[model samples]
Target: MRIIVYGSLRREQGNSHWMTNGQWLGDHVIDGYELYSLGHYPGVIKGMGKVYCEVYRIDATMLAELDALRSKGGEYKRELTSTPYGSAWLYVYQHSMAGRKRIVSGDWLQRDKES
Candidate 1:
């Protein structure tokens, strides 16, 4: 199954992070997702605007696992949406707080400045 992930989950190395066990989808920057900063942590509000995602190609098993995780949290959600890949699932950011925010960077294979 293919999935689109938009938010801090973005992996600078791949579309998906091994930590999440999700296959890397791709790199993309979409808006409409609400931004709610929780100190060091943050959340996004989906369906708020025109949020785009960095897609990743992953196995169905992994997708299901991630789906479950997203559902468990108020900050993330797996929504049934259409994508270029086909009828797939997408995780959008749910704003837990309130604030006008912008993503400074995400996983894009360009490499994090930390390196």
Candidate 2:
């Protein structure tokens, strides 16, 4: 299965170690979505903007591990979304975005540099 990673799961980020087994498919920009700052990481939700992400192809074992790390039903909800490369599962924020700062640039790494 393919997975789209936008925040800490991206290359060189804190949680990227978990994705080491997957094959890097390259970077992609997914539109019709918004990214918000959640301090150490970023959250994505359906909206009217773009999101920068990296695509990866992983096996069911890796998927299970990722789902566990993401806490599927709590912090984030996995959703099937279309990416430039193809269709893939991406995590969307589960709770509220009321007080979170929106990442206007849609690029988490760029947003981090601004801080």
Candidate 3:
């Protein structure tokens, strides 16, 4: 599956490294979906804040592992996101970002060329 990461998990050495597949679909600068209320909802926040990540097509096992990684963040839930490249598995803001401004394309924040 093609995964769309919005946070530090995009880092080459982030804790979610276990979910990284053989190749990255592309480098994307997506928005940060902040979780609120002890990880229950998205709450209030604009979808403008940027985050960088390498998109990849992983397997079911990887998807499950990613779901586990998401548990670390309090209020994130899986949702479908349409990206420039294609459809992706995006972690929704849930009730945390209830009234935030929406963004079409998120930002990629990885500055390291190696990443």
- C-alpha local distance difference test of each model: 0.53, 0.92, 0.53
Off by over 4 Å in 2: 113-115
On lDDT, the candidate that comes out on top is 2
Ordered by TM-score, highest first, the candidates read 2, 3, 1
**Please, what are the lDDT tens digits per residue for candidate 3 over residues 10-102?**
554445466546356787655544322222122223344554455777788888877886656554577766666788877754443444433
lDDT of 2 by residue, 22-51 (tens): 999999999999999988989999999999
Global fold similarity of model 1 (TM-score): 0.55
Which is superior by lDDT, 2 or 3?
A: 2
Taking all chains together, the TM-score of candidate 3 against the true structure is: 0.57
Question: Against the hidden reference, what TM-scores do the models get?
Answer: 0.55, 0.93, 0.57
User: How high is the lDDT of residue 71 in model 3?
Assistant: 51
Q: Which stretches of candidate 3 lie above 4 Å from their native place?
A: 30-51, 72-74, 95-115
Local lDDT at 101 for model 3: 36
lDDT ranking from best to worst? 2, 3, 1
**lDDT, model 3:** 0.53
